[model samples]
Target chain A: MDQFTLNLIVVGATFALYFGIAIWARAGSTAEFYAAGGGVHPIANGMATGADWMSAASFISMAGIIAFGGYDTSAYLMGWTGGYVLLAMLLAPYLRKFGKFTVPEFVGDRFYSGTARVIAVICLLIISITYVIGQMSGVGVAFSRFLEVSNDTGLYIGAAVVFAYAVLGGMKGITYTQVAQYVVLIIAYTIPAIFISLNLTGNPIPGLGLFSNDTASGVPLLTTLNGMLADLGFASYTEQHDTTLNMFLFTMSLMIGTAGLPHVIVRFFTVPKVADARSSAGWALVFIALLYLTAPAVGAMARINLINTMYPNGVKETPVARADVPDWVANWEKTGLLKFDDKNGDGLINYTSSAETNELDVNKDIIVLANPEIAQLPSWVIALVAAGGLAAALSTAAGLLMAISSAVSHDLIKGQLNPGISEKGELLAARVSMAVAIGVATWLGLNPPGFAAQTVALAFGLAASSIFPVLMMGIFSKRINSKGAISGMLVGLIFTVVYIFLHKGWFFIASTASYSDSAPMLFGIKSTAIGSIGALLNFAVAFIVSNATEDTPAEVQELVESIRIPKGAGAATGH
Target chain B: MADKSSSNAYWKANIRAIQIFLVIWFVCSFGFGILLRPMLAGIKIGGTDLGFWFAQQGSILVFLVIIFAYAAKMNKLDREHGVEE
Candidate 1:
């Protein structure tokens, strides 16, 4: 069969499975809709969280970034995975024990102020919306490439499919579907990796294969790669190029942001017990690591393969003829992502950093998607990768939409605006909110600001600066007053957003950015690394305000004490 | 009164475990993976140095172990303090 037909069959089958699970696990009540009836097993919840956490960026873009950026991108790997440690240790168990429905609800109740909750709702919406836009565009790109449709049409189909499952199942339906997605995505990611690993290193395991000697060269893969890159005037693969300070700050921002993301935080609320919440984070990381550990190996090996294919006679020798460029380059050229220009009219492809002589410009996003094709892998493997990318995009989109809907229906409307709203009314509101959110996300996805992974990083930075500090203070420090929390959140949110807008353009208009991501750093920190500094400012401001004004109320102090002790953590229950 | 003291003790034990694990967490990712990476440059693993391994693979593996360790140890403490749910 043709590659397109095989992709359609595999992708169509996966969508059918998701829809079937959605109908079977359809949520019936407010409890079911908001928290999956709070009955999910620890392991099952962990699997779902894994799907929620690993978005399209992880599946499609991360390896590509690592492939080109070399050691500098290790910050992403460490930053993302290291975050669950902070979450499991500091946040998950305590939040689960609080036994509330949404994050804003905890903030409102813990601080004894409705205003605090409203601010939290605003933060949740901002972060979740920004995060969802990336997923939406990811869905569009996956569909466009695999199904041979326009990007906009692919986006609409992706949005409609997500709407069906998310609206029907709520958290309940989404959870089970996410578990299935985790399985599909992990298999899709690992299979091609194993094949490519064996081809390059004679080892079946990709993770170990990364360290093994290359079969063709009989030298360590990294040693060969570093030598080849240096010969071509590129940086060494094994060395760090980013400033250490920037790497530390960027990694810290991602860690805090991961812990603070509302979608992932809400998943813990579904587990049966606080202990389960703790264990669930561990299991989730284990599942996530299955992909992460393989990513570097996949990236390094893919780079080697591409380099070898391009320079069959080696880089020090003559350049390959333009007419001889492979099908993969031609396939990507149509999308304008991969460009080749014979500047000297020599009709040969020369890839180098030098602007005057460079002949090919490869978009970083294309590397992972084109890897299987570059290696001459079978059609089924390519088809599976398409299905996996869609699964990653859709699962994360569903999780983000769930967070947005719950924040609207449960936190905003029911909690503050209409305290007398009926349970049935709230459930209806949640579904309607989800539909509207998907619509807006799809519209914005048609013209995304940056690549899927870069836009997703902005969401993390926003979360790191705003939501994380407030949530951490609410649980860890009893002395922090509502006034302090509010001030800290506003300051952090505003400062971080302004910094990003200045560099990323006001609302990402591209023409408006005064500075690029590199150079003119704030104290030698890039915009991405500024989130950690914003978090620090938040903590400092919150503490200064709390000490200068009033301490936490007496009853609130007792609430803090109760959350600290985990004795009475009943099995998960809806509010 | 006795029950109150025991619960307080349990909370303290929980906090202590978190503290210990967090220290380990920082050491693995931020320490060995980033700051102390240059120091470990002398120790080669496979094709790269020890620091590169920590950054990509070692830290994540350690993070997994830390969480499970915290969970198991905390549950044991909970049972010991008569606070298990």
Candidate 2:
């Protein structure tokens, strides 16, 4: 079968599986809808959370980023996964003990202020919306590439499929579907990686193969790759180009940001026991690390393979004839993801990037999504990759939509708008909220405020500064009263957003954004590294504000201590 | 009552253990990978400096080990604390 047909079959079957699970596992009660009835097995919840957390960035963009950015891109790998450690150690267990349905619920109850709740809700909405935009666009990209539809048309189909499961199944249904999605994505991701690894290094395990010697030339694969990339004027695949300070701070920001993200944090609430929350986080990281470990391998190997295909004999050799170019080049060229221009009117495909030498400019996002075709792998593998990308996007989108819907229905309409609401009425409200969330996400996916997916990093930065701080203070420090929490969040939220907007538009940093990261970062801090500093500012302001305010009530003080000690912690469900 | 006291002691000890492990985490990732990277810059690994490995793969692998070890040890701690469910 051709790549398109194979992708259609694989992606079609994956969606059919998710939709079927949604039908079979439709949530019956608000509790089930919201928390998966608080009884998910620890390992199962871990897998689902892994699926939710990875998203389009992890599945599609990461390998591509590393392939091109070389070792400097390790910031992404370490920063993202290292954050899981912080999550498991610092935040997850405590939040699970709080036993709330939503991150905002914990915020409201712990701070004893509706203002704190509202701030958290705003942060959650911003994070979820920005995050979802990427997922929807990813869905669209995958569909357009594999299913022969336009990007917008692909988004509409993706939105429809997402609505089918998210509205009907709620968290309960979403959890199981996400777990299934995780399996599909990992299988799809690892299969091509294994093949490429064996072909390159004669090592079956891509993770180990990255460090091992190249069987063909008896040199370390990374060593060979770095030399070749440098010869072409690109940074070596293993060489560090970023300043140490920036790398450290960037990784720290991602770690704190990951720990603070409300969507990932809320997953712990679904498990039955405090221990389960702890163990679940560990399991989630294990699953996530499976791909994270292999990403560098794939990135390095793909860079090598791409250079080889372009040069044919070796990177030092003359370029290959376009008309006689390999079949893989033609396949990806049709998708417009892979391309070569004979800038000097030479029939050969030039693969260098210096001012003097002609070069082919490849989109960084295509390195992973277009990998199988680029390597001339089997059509089935190409199809599997398409399905995997969709799974990554859909699973994350479902989670984000659930967060948005529950915030509106459970927190806004049910909790505050009408506490006297009947169960039947609330269920309807949840469905309505879910529908609205998906609609808004889909619309934004089309005419994005900017680079739809890139806004995702800003969402993390905002979460790092605003919501995470308030949640930590509320649960861990009773002295941090409602007044302190609210003020601190306001300050953090304002400063972080302003910093990003000045660089990005007030909304997003499209290709047209005035201030690039290369532009003067505040105090020499890269935009990506700004969140950790914002977090510090948040902590400082909270402490100062709390000290200025009156003492906490005796009962609230006791509540904080109890949560701290993890005594009387209740079982939570993953919906 | 004695068992509860013993369990509390176990939990305290486990916290101390986690603290020690976290220090190592910082030293490898934050220290060798960043602040002290210059100190290790002269020492190379596979053509790149020693600091680079810690920044990328070494720190992350260590982090994974720390978490998994903590989970297993913490489970034991919980069992000894009489808190395991």
Candidate 3:
């Protein structure tokens, strides 16, 4: 069958499988809807968390980012994983012990004020919705490319499939479906990487292959990559190209952001006990590490392969003719991910830097998606990648939708607005909220306010500044009070938001509006890296605010004390 | 019993352990790879400096060690607290 047809069949079958599972495992209780009855085994919950955490960026864009950005981008590899340690130590077990239905619900109760809950809910909504739109866009992009449909048509199809899987099953269905997605995404990511790894370094493992020698050049792949990149007017591939301070801050930002994300935190709630919460995080890291560890290898090898393809005579050979370029080029060209203008009209594709800062601005998004084709791999592999990209996007979008809906129903509508709402009524409200969220996400994806990468970074920034500090202090320190938490989040949130807006926009300041991400950040720290600084400010502010105000209430002090110890954890569930 | 108590006390001593390891991890990844990189510019490792190693591989390896250590230590703490499952 044709590659497009094969893609439709494979992706379609996977969706059908997920849809079937959703139908078979439809939730029957409010408990099941929110936390999958809190009965999920640690391993199952871990796998589900992996699927939720990976998202479209991890599956589709990460390797590409690593490929082009080189060693400097290892921040992504480490920062994303490193946050789990923080989550495990300072956040997860305590939250599990507090054991509420939602993150904002815990915030509302712990702070003992509806205002705190409402503020927390707004933050949750902003972060979750922004993150979800990118996932929707990924779904549309993948579908249009592999299924030969228009982008809008593909988005609607993706939305419908996700609705079928998520609305009926809620948390229960989404969890298992995510577990399946993790398996699919990992397989799709790895198979191509393994093939490319063996071809380049004569090594089977992509992670190790990065450090091993390139058989073609008889030099280590990283060393060869660095040399080739430097020759092309780019920074050395394995060198510290960016400022060390910014790199440190950026990595720290992403780590805290990972810990604070509501959707990721909610996944831990589905597991049974405090220990399960801890173990599940460990397992989630194990599963997530599989992708993260492979990513650098994939990026390095892909970079090497792309260079080899363009410079058949090793940086001196004439590039292949644009028109007669291979079928792989033709296929990706349709997706607008790979293009050729023949600026010099010599017909030979001049893929080199223009010798004056490379006016060729290739979007980094296409790197991982186009990896197989760059290496001249088969059509089926390309189609499978398309499916994998959809799996990543759809899985994350579903989880974000759950967080949003829960915020609306559990935190806003029922918890504060109508405390006496019946379980049946609450469940209905959740479904409606989910439907509305999906509609908004779909619309936003179609018209994306900014680039997908920028939007994801903003989501991380907001979470890092606003949510991480509150959650950590809520668990680790008994001194922090409502006033402290609120003031801290406000200061951190405003600082990070204003900094990002100063660079990104007044509100996601656009590049077209005479702003730049490279605008002189404080201490030469870029706007993106300042999120971690914002988090530190948040912690400091919380402490200062608490001491300046009244001591925490006796009940609140007792609550904090109890959450620290492991016993009575399951019973501490404020059911 | 002595061995178990020693392990338990080691586990309970949290500030020192987390502080020591986190400092090392931070120094390797953020400090060496990023901050002091200019200072370590001439110290080469496979055609690059120690800073470059931290950015690409050294920092990541250290992060892995930190997490595994944390997990191991926490597990021991649980047993000592008589909270082992």
**Highest TM-score against the true fold, candidate:** 1
lDDT of 1 by residue, A533-575 (tens): 8899889998999889998888998888777767687655545
Sorted on lDDT, highest at the top, how do the candidates line up? 1, 2, 3
Identify the superior model by TM-score, candidate 1 or candidate 3.
1
* DockQ-best of 1 and 2: 1
lDDT per residue as tens, model 2, A422-465: 87788889999999999999999998765565567688888888
Select the stronger candidate by lDDT from 1 and 2: 1
Top DockQ: which candidate number? 1
The positional error of residue A140 in candidate 1, measured at the CA in angstroms, is 1.1
Runs of candidate 2 with Cα error greater than 4 angstroms are: A355-357, A509-515, A573-575, B1-18, B38-50, B79-85
List of chain B TM-scores, one per candidate:
0.94, 0.83, 0.73
Best-matching candidate per lDDT = 1
Superposed Cα deviation of residue A187, candidate 1 (Å): 0.9
Q: How does chain A of candidate 1 score by TM-score against the true chain A?
A: 0.97
Model 2 C-alpha lDDT per residue in residues B3-79, reported as the tens digit of each score: 44564476467558768877977888788777787799898665567776776678878887888787787777766
Docking class of 1: medium
Q: Taking the tens digit of each residue's C-alpha lDDT, what string does model 3 give over A297-331?
A: 88878777777766667765566665565665676
- Cα TM-score per model: 0.97, 0.94, 0.93
- C-alpha positional error of residue A23 in candidate 1 after TM-score superposition, expressed in Å: 0.8
- Assess each model's interface with DockQ, reporting 2 decimals per model: 0.74, 0.43, 0.29
| Displacement of the residue A418 alpha carbon in candidate 3, Å | 0.2
Clashing pairs in 1: none
Native contacts kept (model 3): 0.23
